[model samples]
Target chain A: QQPVQSPQAVILREGEDAVINCSSSKALYSVHWYRQKHGEAPIFLMILLKGGEQKGHDKISASFNEKKQQSSLYLTASQLSYSGTYFCGPKRGGADGLTFGKGTHLIIQP
Target chain B: EADIYQTPRYLVIGTGKKITLECSQTMGHDKMYWYQQDPGMELHLIHYSYGVNSTEKGDLSSESTVSRIRTEHFPLTLESARPSHTSQYLCASSGSTSGKETQYFGPGTRLLVL
Candidate 1:
């Protein structure tokens, strides 16, 4: 089943912080974060595994709670370049294909 | 950027036409996938391959077929394209290491069935 994303859309001023949440009905072993700009393919952002691991890069970070079957992506000090639709794909294992959420639209204004 | 590539970045074709979308990756990844997405929508996995000669249909039912004859090449073909097939097709390959599974995507092909 496809995961569900919260706050379908969000608008933020530059340097502001934003959070996008993803939840699945079933337990997930891994959650992947990607950002897709207009007219471009989705770019890999971060991956969070089970065991409540947290991962991030630059100012973007994510936390995974396997028990809750949910993950949250944190974008700190958002920039205009960060404007894009963020997707969260959940997988049970490495070989299992991902089930992506509808995605959260994030627009960072200058 | 990923070494993966997809041909025909954009295509406008008449219905019932047979078309093939080519995807190739030089990263030597064992897993390759095809996803369909509408404008500003969720990605739906249509096909995937574990390796050469190992193809699988994803959760989303698709009318297209895929062939994995070579490790670095996976192509998707539609026998009779329809207007419903008009969408963005994304090709991705994933590499795993120490529990980190990262997928690299191609620029994608935007197909418009007329």
Candidate 2:
């Protein structure tokens, strides 16, 4: 099943911070994040495995809480370049095929 | 950036036309997938492949079919296109390391079935 994402859309100013959340009804073994700009393909951000670990990429980072079956993407000091839709792909178990969420629309204005 | 590439970045065809969406990856990843999505919407997995000669349908019911005849290539075909088939088709390949799998996606093909 597809995970649920919160704050379907958010607007932030440059240098501001924002958080997007993804939660699944089933337990998730791994969570992957991607960002897609208008008219472009989704780009890999980071992946967090069960261990309840936090992974970071540049100013963006994510935390995976296997216990809660949820993952949160944190964007700090957001830049205009960060304006795009963020999707969380959580896999319960088995293969690498991920069930993606509806996505969080983030807009960063200068 | 991902080495995956897709052809016919944008297509506009009439109904009952046959079209093939080509996907190729130079990374030599054995796992590939196809996802369908509408504008500003969620992604739906339509098909996937483990390796050559191994293809499987995904959660979403798709009228399209896919073939994995080579490690680096997986193509999706739609024998007859309709307005409902108009959407963005994304191709992805995943590589595993240390028990973690990350998918690399192509730019995607925007299909407009008129």
Candidate 3:
């Protein structure tokens, strides 16, 4: 099943912070995050593994709550470069393919 | 940079035409995947392969078929294209199943079926 992402879209001013959340009904082995700019493929950001692991990249950080079957990505002190659509890909069991959330469109305005 | 390549950055074709989207990776990754995405939408996995000669259908049912004839190449073919197939096709590869191994994506092929 596809995960659910909250706040389908968000707008933030420079240096502001924002959070994008992803929740799934199924048990997740890992949660992967990626950001995609206009007309481009997604770029890997971070991966949160099971057993409550956290990962970060630059000002972007994410945490996976296994018990809640949810993940949250944090963007701190946002920059214009941070404007993009963020997707959460969840890995269930031993499957190679990931189930992705609809996506959260983030806009950082100067 | 990761060595994943996709050919034909953009393609426009008429209905009933056959088309193949090419994807290649030099990272020696064992797993490759093909995903379809519309503008401002989430990626939907259409097909994937674990290794050479191994192919599997993803959660989303697709009209496309893929081949893993070699380790570096995984191509998706549509025998008959339709307007519904108009979207961006992304190719990705991962080194392992650990999830920590980030999946590297190609630039993608944007197809417009008229």
Candidate 4:
């Protein structure tokens, strides 16, 4: 099943911060975060595992709560380039593909 | 950067015509997936493959079919395209790195049926 993302859309001033949340109804083995710019492919931001281990990305960070089947993505000092639609994918360990949330559209303006 | 690629970044075809969307990855990852998404909508998984010759339908019931005959290629086909089938098709692949896997996506193909 697909995860649910909060704050369907948000507008932020440059240098501001924002948080995007992803909640799943089913237990999750891992939660993945991705960002897709308009007319571009979705890029992998990071993956948070069941044991609370986080992997990937340089500027952005995320936290995974396996117990609650939720994950939150943190973007600090957001830049204009950070504007895009963010998606959270809750995954179960298997050959099946990750289930992506509806997505959060973030817009950063000067 | 991810080496995955999708051809015909945009396609406009007539109804009832068959079309194949090409997806290829140079990373040689064992896991590949195909997703369809309408503008401003969530990405829906149409198909996925763990390895060569292993193909499975995803949660979304799609009229499309996919084949994974080669490790580097996974293509999706629609036997008879319709207006309802118009959407952006994205291809992605994931590889394990120290027990964690990161998926890399292609540019995506935007298809329009007239």
Candidate 5:
């Protein structure tokens, strides 16, 4: 099943913070986060496994809740380069293709 | 940079014409997928292949067919193009089933059928 993401859009200023949430109706084996710039392919950012593992990249971090089947992405001190669409892809049990969220458009200005 | 490539990044064709979107990856990954997306929209999986000679339809029912004859190439073909088929086709590959193994995506093929 496709995951639901909250706050379809957000605007932030340089050095601001933002969070994007993804919740799945079914049990998710993993949650993957990706960012896509205008006219560009989605780039993988981080992945949270079923075991409630957390991963971080630069000022970006994510936490996975196995019980709630939810994942949250945190962007600290956002930069102008952070302006893009963010998608959450959840991997269900034995599922080959990742089910993607509707995505959240993020705009960061200086 | 990702080694995946999609040819003819932009295509505009008439209805009833047959078209093929080519996707090739030099990464030698066993898993490949094809997804369709409109501008500023969410991605929808259309097809995927676990390996050569193994292909499966994704959650979305598509009029297109895909072939995985070689490990490095996974191509999607539409028997007859229509305006509804117009969208961006993205190709991606992954090394394993592990969640940590990030999937690399190609720039994508943008098609416009009129």
Candidate 6:
């Protein structure tokens, strides 16, 4: 089943912070985060494995809670370049095909 | 910086036309996948391959078929395209590394069946 993403869409001002949450009914093995600009491919942002591991990028971070079967991506000091659709995909067991959420539309205003 | 590529960035064709979407990756990834995405919507996995000669259907039932004759190439073919088949086809590849199966994507082919 596809994971659920919160805040279907969000508008943010530059330098503001936003959080996107993804939860799945099934247990998760790893969570993958990707960002896609208009008419472009989804770019890999980060991947959070099980064991409650957290990964971060420049002002972009993500956390995975294995027990909760959920993941959260944090966009700190959001920039205009951060404007895009964010997708969270959680992998369960040996499944190679990832089921992506509907995606969280993030708009950052200058 | 992943070297995945897709051909025919955009295609507009009439219904009943046969088409093939090509995807190739130079990163030597063991796994490759094809995902169909509608504009501003979630992606649905159509097909995937673990390596050359190993193709499998994805969670979403797709009418298109895929082939993995070479490790770096996975192509999708539609014998007879329909309007319902119009969608963005995204190709992605990932290495076999455990706990680090981060997939890198191609620019994608936006297909339009008239």
Top of the candidates by DockQ: 1
Per-residue lDDT, model 2, residue A33, is: 94
User: What are the per-residue Cα lDDT tens digits for candidate 5 across A12-90?
Assistant: 8899999999999998888899999999999999888877888899999999998999999999999899999999999
Worst 10 residues of 6 chain B by lDDT: B94-103
Span of ten consecutive residues with least summed lDDT in model 2 chain B:
B94-103
Cα lDDT of model 4 by residue, A5-106, tens digit: 999999999999899999999989888898998888888887888876654355678999898888999888888999999999988875579889999999
- Pairs in clash, predicted candidate 3: none
DockQ of each: 0.86, 0.77, 0.78, 0.82, 0.78, 0.79
Residue-level lDDT of model 2, residues B1-114, one tens digit each, is 679999989999999999999999999898999999899998888898888999988879999999998999999999999999999999999987887888999999999999
Per-residue lDDT tens digits of candidate 1, residues B39-71? Answer: 999999999888999999997999999999999
Docking class of 6: medium
Q: Indicate whether candidate 1 or candidate 3 has the larger lDDT.
A: 1
Candidate no. 5 TM-score: 0.97
Task: Write down the TM-score of every candidate.
Answer: 0.98, 0.97, 0.97, 0.96, 0.97, 0.97
lDDT of 5 by residue, B13-41 (tens): 99999999999999999899999999999
Worst 10 residues of 2 chain A by lDDT: A91-100
The C-alpha stretches of model 2 lying farther than 4 A from their native spots are none
Mark the regions of model 4 whose C-alpha exceeds 4 Å error after superposition: A54-58
Once fitted onto the true fold, the runs of candidate 1 whose alpha carbons sit more than 4 angstroms away are none
lDDT value, residue B39 of candidate 3: 90
For model 4, what fraction of the real interface contacts is kept? 0.82
Q: List the residue pairs that clash in candidate 1.
A: none
Q: What residue pairs clash in candidate 6, if any at all?
A: none
**Residue runs of model 6 more than 4 Å from their true location after superposition:** none
Which regions of candidate 3 deviate over 4 angstroms? B97-99
TM-score of chain A of 5: 0.97
Task: Give model 6's TM-score versus the native structure.
Answer: 0.97
